[model samples]
Target: MALRMKVTYLDGREEVVTILPPIFMAAEKHFKRDGGLSERNKVASTYYMTWQALQKFGREENDFDAFLELIEEIEDAEDEAEDPTGPAPQPDESSS
Candidate 1:
């Protein structure tokens, strides 16, 4: 599935930006490469990596501030997807 964000340009034009699953997966590896660094550095590195990755999908470099919102949305969705408690509980068959 693709995740998309709507950007409203300064000139009153609105456009939808999308990131496909492949790009997201590839970008994650680059983002994680700085895992050994301090939190501050990691945040900066992650933003840079995200910027670079999105650029490949046609996002403008000058619009990084808008991309920041998309990045946060993607990360939040990822966190929710990886959440263990998010799945439905299975039936217990212990008494069978």
Candidate 2:
């Protein structure tokens, strides 16, 4: 799935643009490469890189719903791989 960013101009105009996931994935890989850094620092650096890249691509904000879905999918896939019998987590009722 393509990672998308919503760009809003100074004049209040907005547009959605695709940002290659590999870019963010690369930042994560880099963070993992250096195990010496504190976990907080690694996570912060990765997110910082993500934001910088979004700005470089002219994105104003992230599509939070899509991001959450992506995270859920990844977690589900990992769970399936690790334990086939594991049930997926239920969505929060309050969110509905």
Candidate 3:
């Protein structure tokens, strides 16, 4: 399955970025030299994937640190794509 995620920027723009093999290969190089992709390194995998997606998709080509600063949120495009709960229930206004 494609590793898809919704990337939201600080400027309020949101995009659905797909992580392809090129992105994974790059991450593999980086992590192999730094830390292997063990379960503990899941965050590293996620961030690298997001960064590469942003760059590869022409969304933002900044270096990783700069790209990190631009991201406001990261959500799974697959799981939340069909949120069964729907929107979070609003607080009851008549309670008090």
Model 3 Cα lDDT, one tens digit per residue, 1-96: 468888888999887778887887777787896665557777768887888887887887799888789888777787546355769988999988
Using lDDT as the measure, which candidate wins? 3
What are the root-mean-square deviations of the candidates from the true structure over C-alphas? Answer: 11.9, 13.4, 6.4
Query: 1-96, model 1: which lDDT tens digit per residue?
Result: 665444444455444445466655655565566553256564554454445545775655656676555432323233223234567888899977
Q: How accurate is candidate 1 locally (lDDT)?
A: 0.51
Flag regions of model 1 displaced more than 4 Å. 34-54, 57-96
Which digits, one per residue and each the tens of the lDDT, describe model 2 over residues 1-34?
A: 4444443444555344443566656566666756
Give the candidate number with the greatest TM-score: 3
Candidate 3, TM-score vs. the true structure?
Answer: 0.71
Clashing residue pairs for model 2: none
TM-score of each: 0.36, 0.28, 0.71
Q: If ranked by lDDT, best first, what sequence of candidates would result?
A: 3, 1, 2
What clash count goes with each model?
Answer: 0, 0, 0
